[model samples]
Target: MRKLDEAHLCESVGDSTSTYFMKDQKSVTGLYTERQKNHFLVHSVACLGTEMHLAACPLEFNKGNATASCPGGVLPAVVSCIPGPLYTHSLALKKKLKTTTSVRLKGGTHQGEGRVEVLRGSEWGTVCDDRWNLQAASVVCRELGFGSAKEALTGARMGQGVGPIHMNEVQCSGQERSIWNCRFKNITSEDCQHTEDASVRCNTPYMGFHKMVRITGGRSQYEGRVEVLSLDVNRTQRWGLLCGEGWSTREAMVVCRQLGLGYANHGLQETWYWDGSNVTDMAWSGVKCVGDELALSQCQRHKVFSCQKTATRFAAGVICSETASDLVLNAPLVQQTVYIEDRPLHMLYCAAEEDCLSKSAAKANWPYGHRRLLRFSSEIRNIGRADFKPKAGRHSWVWHACHGHYHSMDIFTHYDLLSLNGSKVAEGHKASFCLEDSECQDGVAKRYECANFGDQGITVGCWDLYRHDIDCQWVDITDVKPGNYIFQVVINPNFEVAESDFTNNAMKCNCKYDGHRIWLHNCHIGDAFSEEAERKFEKYPGQLNNQITRK
Candidate 1:
């Protein structure tokens, strides 16, 4: 997510009715678990699923311990319910939804995941991955009577299809019931290939997967230390902690999915601060996943109980969210506008004040030396549903005496030059002095402006552009040796803001420096290519550095 500051993103929650009916797993019940001193044990609770809240159910609390209220294997109530779809498309698209005979999914392992194919006339075709996103994929999901998309895959992730490419650059508002109701570009033969076919994983019916695992000691329902319920050799059920060692976002993603949480904002490896759970037995360890698993138990793990740290403070935890912003840099723009500028120190007063130049500049003669700056334009687009707002409000914005503007965020972006092994050679940053809508789509009116101390934020369908001429937009590479390197631009590098997908927040380009000049090529988003292609890119040989950079 291209966020303005190092803080968790937040959105206001409004009262709304849930779309699906849900029930807990019988194996794990409320009455069987450990309880706090002040916690109540409600008994004989019964009500139809249609009730808005548990308060509507006939409930009675135990006067003492849980054993006194419930006995004879009478654990907490285990309900059986057939859940409906978690979401539906807009009612305004009712008429268009009926005409969804055009689109279909294929080659899926399950019902709601597959390569998206559309019918052009009577012949089935596929969609190009260009500009394909969750918004457009959600439309197709709802059209197929499923919930919103869990993943909008690209580059034929579900497998390639053989047919004409019917659509390119699909743009949907996510409210449309069908992909046909959204704006799109007609595909040209040269515009797309079968290799770029789009695919999706839509949200399916509730399966009570969340009941098997849970988060405890979080400030909200979306965050906490992870605990899983599993049976021992004697078939006795117990809840235990997952080892924090080697835990990462991929593991967190599976946990969130299993828990019916939207997405994993953070895969925290430590839970020392969350004091809610006293369970300290490390039941699992060495869990590794590719991030598409439906359950944590399905992930690869060590056969024996093993952990570097067995303490409860080292338990795996997660912070989940229903929505988050996603930021993508304009790769083509970065390639088209990259150049070197030997800026005189006298003219870099503002840049110096902002600490944009390399640290070696401090030892140079007063306003005499020229700093070789690698300049490029950065265009950050918020592709997520949530607006990208500054974590700190106006009251906390820091004023910059030199720039004569308020710095809304401490660090908005990071521009770096990295070696082949991914060690940083040099770096620069764009402090968010002004974050406003630099431009918007055709129908998206500008909602943020930096002029006259106006509201600052990048709304959906809008972008914030930092031109090459702007101060602090370039990495100072004067002290570095000229050789092959990677030019990487990381948005929200600190993960300060919550984003739907942090994997795509980085844009990288192959760079070759030859003392006097620099060349950049193959600039693309981090997740734009396949794993194999990315591996080859990372291991790119030095011999290939002689080629002319693409314009």
Candidate 2:
């Protein structure tokens, strides 16, 4: 490993050709001069000399930052290992873009650490999570297929990194990345509780759901027009028959605290009239958005809605409704995951479950609307963004859909239903999400908006994982930017069975011959659709097509 006099070394070693003696003794400075240098063969030594010269020539001769460096002068004294050049730039690969190709921009939640990867124009890459730890890494490990459920892992980074993660002012928690990776605020390193937060990007997969519910009834209504009730409103399936019969007013909010933004403002006023049918009236005349104090008094709620102190821009109390505006509200839909114990069934004939077999059929497929082709297209994107940019992920796509057949007629038809004893039959047509059940709750009328975002498919059927629990809304991985994106569902804490005889139909009307008269119906998914809702659906019907349970 050391240098020696070329004469003594080459002679003692015998095979001068095999030993690479330094022709220039000046090359060996750091080690003992009398020491013998090791080399495989003359040719191998010569090759090594070449590489060494290339690596060191720059350090020895290159002008500082100047491009005037000259070629090297070769010699028989083959250089050993050459010193590295002053500097070198790293290289990364890039490629073309293909569908289904996604990269993790950021991720790490629940006291877990996350890592970001790059898929250069077309090349795949890895990163060094030197600061990663088990405490905040479950999401990352799952995303990368590293571990089933992230367990405590230990090791220094053993891979190269790409792109930039801007972790400069960040600090790690002895875990991975930095506490900030989990989207948590910077805190004292040693004095925090076990529950920590982090931030991440991209890569949100469809996991499971947190909760689901069937809304019931409308809150307010209008006049002249006939109000009709659909089979079952609570059941996410049945579809609004029409709004002519009546109008109800009420709003529902399903919240998932983890996901600061994921929540449902169902039965919103904006949604009530999104469908093409003519609504008798917008019942949510004075309802306010639940969160924003300003919007609370703006959305037609009877009273001003109040926002929680925590949320400002949002009506923590305010929510968007689809009563009288565009269909865009209907476009934004929700998806989730769940487990159905038994395929929804019905025992009684009063529109319990199977009655509403006729759901809004899938749109007629066009020549260019092949399922596979559409799978890779942006139709889902445009639809989703319009629908609410719903959570994106596997089993996730924008499916444009609508349910319920419509009927329009005179007040006599509705007037007859209200007067008929067991003769719920009407004389003319009616308007409502559904006709059979025209008991629109006041709260419901305020919420039943018919916005642009029409019916979109959601998380459905997961009887395999969880029994008696059915809600696929939480299956969206899109918009699930790694860091702290939450998966949540709100379940009814009470297991009490509900019975209702209310119709879920309500509306406002203004005709020349007859003045407007507000009507209401009953169903689930509303304030009136409670455990006390006596046989409302008993006369109405429901079906899986509605994407929900019975009244």
Candidate 3:
């Protein structure tokens, strides 16, 4: 009984199975069902005609059965259809429909913040900064998935744009979705010039090469030592320390943004407070930034770099804001792919060395028991505005001969099968996962991959999907008996990495087992529901579980 736009609808049903119906009827009808034993069914009908308003009555059905059924047989639902055709065609059929135009930022090294340009009739054009403002610039920022405009620049601040100046006197109310929706004047050759080309510094999401950097060694989350991961000519990912020489607030600002933290309160060239880790190899020196760039690589550096202080004590450090990095589990995939498999103990030597098995496994006889593993596909998405990189460098990454891939972080994700009272019965852990773009949104390309030891990290608008068949993606539940339990998955369990919001990081599902086959339902994002609803979800034992709720 609610209206939804295409974008919101896609997000809501993204993890669920859905069906769409399109018919040449006067009205469109829909039926929705809630996931509960005694649920409500609301039926709605709307007009199919474009630009026509129609009102339909909502019919509510009260049912005792879990599945929806028509008790009184098929009811003839009627709606107040407007007296008009489905679509209205103008008499001037010769007029062509407006073709879609494209926008891009040039000159700047990063995406979202750059010189303004438009694509028209297969030709790229520019915008004249006659009356450009933050309002107009924000429209472009929003269209590019950035937050808003931080600054609306003019006089070729990001360098002059080439080709025709197609727009001038641009104005926006700041609420428009795109620059095309705003009011602007079409320009001729004499109306405007490239010297006045408009540029925008958008409050864009932290992305690109900046994702490969991390901060460590500080006492608090805000204050930390600095490190970076880079790819060598050999295609091997390596992590090394940074020389603190010439490090300033400008460089710290980029670091804070890359880590999803706010602006830098203090950038330190030398810090003896946090030298706990063994990472002392200096890989960069003479690092400089403009305080506006997204990544350190975008900053200026000396052609031939060397560090005066070879010690890690002189490494770069920064005190950033409290807010950074947020990780969340893919709830839909857990419910759909959860299954059980039996693995031999003889084949678990690498897992044992990695401490993936429980402490009890150490005391058991060598290669004795068959571990009943609860396996499922997990898609850990970096939904926050910034990328999530491992805090450790490649020197510390563990290479598993059996897996043939390096583990980047010591502890990345935690999986557990807990009793109703919150008692843990079985557990699993994923160590130092390699980040890659399993999928990305339109206009974005897959950059990082684990293949060839490439740079590994999750970029904004990208996700790292671990299939159900992958090694160590399961809980060793060989000891648990047949009963009701809660299946919980927590991403970035250790506070080693920072995130913007940590509330949505945990996902839980209701599970039922009977020695052989198992069923998981009611899977949902941890913070999506209220505390009371979560308490109810955890309290109820899965004796007669039948519905999967979508919140």
> Candidates' lDDT values, in order?
0.74, 0.22, 0.67
Task: Identify the runs in model 1 with alpha carbons over 4 angstroms from their true place.
Answer: 1-186, 189-208, 215-255, 264-319, 391-396, 451-455, 541-551
Q: Write model 1 residue lDDT over 1-551, tens digit each, in one string.
A: 11112111111111122122333233334423332122225555554323333455455555553333243324333233332322223555554345456687754545577789876543457899999998798778767766667788997766555436888999987666568778999867798886789999987765556788999999998899999998877899999899999888778878877776766777888989998777878788899987667678778999988998988999999988655566778888998999999999898888888888889888889689799999998888876656778767899988887878888889989999999999999999988898899998666788989888888888876889999998898999998898999999999876566565566788889998999888888787775544545666778834323332211
For every model shown, what is its TM-score relative to the native structure?
0.56, 0.17, 0.46
Best model number under TM-score = 1
Ranking by TM-score: 1, 3, 2
Model 3, 408-496: lDDT tens digits are 98788899999988989999998755778888755557778888888878876567898987778888877789998988898877555
Candidate 2 local Cα displacement, residue 351, angstroms: 38
Off by over 4 Å in 3: 1-270, 273-325, 363-369, 541-551
RMSD (CA, Å), each prediction: 16.3, 27.9, 25.5
lDDT of 2: 0.22
lDDT for each residue of candidate 2 in 415-474, tens digit (9 for 90 to 100): 112221233211212112211111221222222122343322211100001111211111
By summed lDDT, the worst window of 10 consecutive residues in model 1 runs over 6-15
Clashes of each: 0, 211, 7
lDDT at 163 for candidate 1? 38
Q: lDDT score of model 1?
A: 0.74
Q: How much does candidate 3 score in TM-score? A: 0.46
